[model samples]
Target: MADDRKVALDAALKKIEKNFGKGSIMKLGEKADQKISTIPSGSLALDVA
Candidate 1:
């Protein structure tokens, strides 16, 4: 069932990370949904314009 599939997928992901190192694979939805905070460029002209 879905639970079994999820278990298998988790095992595969762990194996991949163990061999390739962490953050070698990223889940798109998780990355895409993240909010990026913007900061000022610190230039007067750029900030005004």
Candidate 2:
């Protein structure tokens, strides 16, 4: 289950990098943190749901 999550996250990150252009590679936790930090708190509930 964890492996599947890692693979999915890698694929999603690759797609994001492709669209945004590459710089430094981030660990999964860092990426998640960055996303969560940037999103508005009100919309975070909608995102998780």
Candidate 3:
């Protein structure tokens, strides 16, 4: 799965660099895990599909 996903991400990153500029791609990787884990219990919807 990781190998397949890396191929997909490589394609995506090239598109990002072409359309949005190289800086955007760098910024996205730099901030990928910078989100807050502040989900409120009971306020989130579960997806089964």
Evaluate all candidate structures by whole-model CA lDDT and list the values in order. 0.81, 0.72, 0.69
> By lDDT, who's the top model here?
1
Cα lDDT, model 3, residue 35: 48
> Per-residue lDDT of 1-49 in model 2, one digit per residue for the tens?
9999999998988988898867446665654334334555688678686
lDDT for 7 in candidate 1 is: 97
Which prediction has more favorable lDDT, 2 or 3? 2
Winner on lDDT between 1 and 2 is: 1
| Candidate 2 runs further than 4 Å off | 28-49
Question: Which segments of candidate 3 are over 4 A away from where they belong?
Answer: 27-49
What is residue 7's positional error in candidate 2, in angstroms? 0.4
Per-candidate clash tally: 0, 0, 0
Candidate 2 least-lDDT 10 residues: 31-40
TM-score for each of the candidates: 0.58, 0.47, 0.47
TM-score of model 2 (CA atoms): 0.47
- What is the C-alpha RMSD, rounded to one decimal, of candidate 3? 9.1
Candidate 1: list runs displaced more than 4 Å: 32-49
